[model samples]
Target: MATFCQFAFFIAFGSLVSVHADMKLDCQQDFVSLVWTETRPQVDTSQYRLGNCFPTSVTATQAIFKVELNACKFRKLVTGDLLQYSNNLTYVSSELELLPFSLPVTCVYQRPKDWYPMIYNPVFDTYGQGELLFHIGIMNNDFTGPAESSSFPLGSLIPIMASVQQASHQPLQLFIEECVAATTPQLSPNGDKYTIITNKGCLVDSKVSRSRFIPRQKSSEILGFLQAFRFSTGEQVYVHCTLVAWDPVGLDKTKKACNYVQGHGWELVDNPSYNSLCDCCESSCNARKIRSTPLGNEMVHEVVLGPIMISEFSDSLF
Candidate 1:
């Protein structure tokens, strides 16, 4: 965390006061954030940007910019054993009299002798059992930062990632059977509930919202985009999802990602050859009559993400 300020003296309440437009930068393990706090009433925050990413949140006095470090076009420099990522935060006002300002920001890491590239770890939940480790996290828009936030507004898109870390070298497939959002962390039959993904991996929320399944990078992981919503006004939202690790070659009606395309009906994201399987999404997707035990590399895990306060005041970040 670093703070940079440009001060200007003024008189307020008949007393001499020093005011400054402060810029705070946070270079975390997973992301980089820049905040510009301006007391000048004439300044427009829409003209400010950190690299190509604009402020996700902005108010009369505060503007916040956040993005995955790798997603932003940060310049990279290697000096001997140290690696640096740098960017500039600039404020360009529309008024001719308001001078522009640019703040140089950089984050550096020490490169180890035997260092190999790896992803940064954020606050994530993990279920390590036997040879498989199942984990889930809420990520940034680009699926780079495993993000955590206390507040989200209605209509904001939330990116989520569920993955499996395996000790065994077997190809595995991941799926979200269903997910529900409630005001409480624990689900109750009487509680206010909104089903997002249902009918065996069908994103039913897409029928009403812009929620959809993201393209898969690997069979071992699944990414999803969920629009933030509320069951009750100003109440906390908790998302409970049923995740399963299955054989990539054995994708069936039960293990799939079906997103409701506006004009195209339901479409399979991972395997289009099984579009017939998604037909059940409109009706009912039944379980196999003869349920069999999961494979050695397959398992079912239940994960909960949130305590996210749904607000109407939060600005859309997407």
Candidate 2:
């Protein structure tokens, strides 16, 4: 065993974090991660992402920790997190569940190949926490080359589906970005109609997996499958195939972008409300339709093949 040294880290907000027995405060590593293989105590890690990749795999260390309590018999997972702050030592953690036993967190550290400078400074240190961050799979953006995006005229309904996964194989409607307390969707006998809309804007579509009494063993594919929605009432839309981590608990939905501040403090920053506004990275190539006239007032039937737009799937999706 590597002989460990104990150190106290002081937070500006009158707090101290003693290094955990299994954790080391080091900065020279190329990569550092916290992981485990326990299945029951974890929630959908496939859709879970931070920065550019999912952490639980061989390349990343981010994991979605979930715990089940015997008292109430409920499932919960954390959502919003500021993985790193201004320094190599600062890290943020949300509440998680791992029934019968506490979550086994293993920290792995490696030297970096090439990364931007890191510091830990907060803009508003009073909140004791920074902004909320959402993530998706890294493969969604790993390659380059104009991927297809679809465009749609006004009054078009686009197909949308959200998969709240619990593991690599289990499928459920419980999506966790920041585990506060999430309510399950009320469904009919066959899981057909939802009483308490899980994902708003999407109407009830046909179920692809099993019936209500038994959902598809918690898979990663589809969480809440619904058909189509229109973001705006006016103006045509251009959208790309995107994945998003939706945080239901947010002070301001617009402020979802994450950026590092000074030292050990990464702050949740906001994209400027002008030019190209960036929401959570759902539509990878989500470009806003700026001040432009509708295409010549003549309705064109030809579907232009360019990028994956929400409008392209305005009809069918597999």
Candidate 3:
């Protein structure tokens, strides 16, 4: 009976040893089999531009380490065809390590509209010179907000005019070359209207020059003229009247054409006493004009004036 018991015990011990060896072999094999199925990660092209691209798939050695380590804990057998096994192994490792190692890939995508430059010129009839200058700078959604303004020195105005003219493929107009102080329109209360008033000294319509340019001066006449023109409350008004000179001959002479055309017919200079003359002749000529507000009661005024240098015009325009 004792002998029989010994034989049974030996048989049970051998079976246990066999099972241990099989488990170790299985664990080693599973770990070695882990691999990456995808060579790289896929990239999303919609968000980027300028030929920018991102990666689609990635092959990583660390991912395999994770899969092997995880399987070791669970004593799980790795299953699947070679390709699928590799993919699963990679996925397992990715989950375990939580590593973010991605390769960037690239592909061509269509360009968006509003991506190109917008060029426009605003001319005011108030200035007798056919083209009064206003410049629009290149803007992008990322770098700048919807509304922006800048001031330039009077001297820089000429070069800026030349650059704008070149970019627009048009001849630089003589008026743009002259130095003039200007203010940007401020945003109204409702955010709808932008109004800027530039003091363009008393402009006489070529047809009715004599009627507006008479020599007699009086304060009452100026006050009356200003009051006669009604301005709605909260309206943005920019007045850019000449402080030192009415028709700036200095500005005209600065231009290349005006210098060469010595006696050109364009009456570049208006009478220097035009402001005083207007104040004396027209009642209320210097009174502020009222503007209506688009927003109920929200009104703001952004005013700028200067003895600005002509050379700094380009930076200010943008």
**Winning candidate number (TM-score):** 1
User: Model 2 over residues 115-231: C-alpha lDDT tens digits?
Assistant: 222331222111212322212211111112222333433223222222333232111122211111011122124422222121211111222211111111121222222222333
Full-model lDDT for every candidate? 0.69, 0.24, 0.20
After superposition, the stretches of candidate 3 with alpha carbons farther than 4 Å from their true spots are: 1-156, 159-284, 288-300, 303-318
Which digits, one per residue and each the tens of the lDDT, describe model 3 over residues 1-318? 011100000011112122311110112322322212322234222211111211122233112222332332221111111110111111112332332221111111122322221322212111121222333221121222221332223221111111111221211222211122222243234533212111232222212211111111110011001110112222332322221111111222221111101232222222332223332222222433422322111111122322222222233321
Candidate 2 — which residues are off by over 4 angstroms? Answer: 1-35, 38-318
Model 3, TM vs. native: 0.14
Report the Cα lDDT for candidate 2: 0.24
Residue 166, candidate 1: Cα error in Å is 1.9
Residue 210's C-alpha lDDT in candidate 1? 83
Q: List TM-scores for all candidates, in order.
A: 0.56, 0.19, 0.14
Error of 3 at 293 (Å): 3.2
lDDT of 1 by residue, 40-117 (tens): 788888787777787899998888988886776775433334445666666667676655655556666654455432
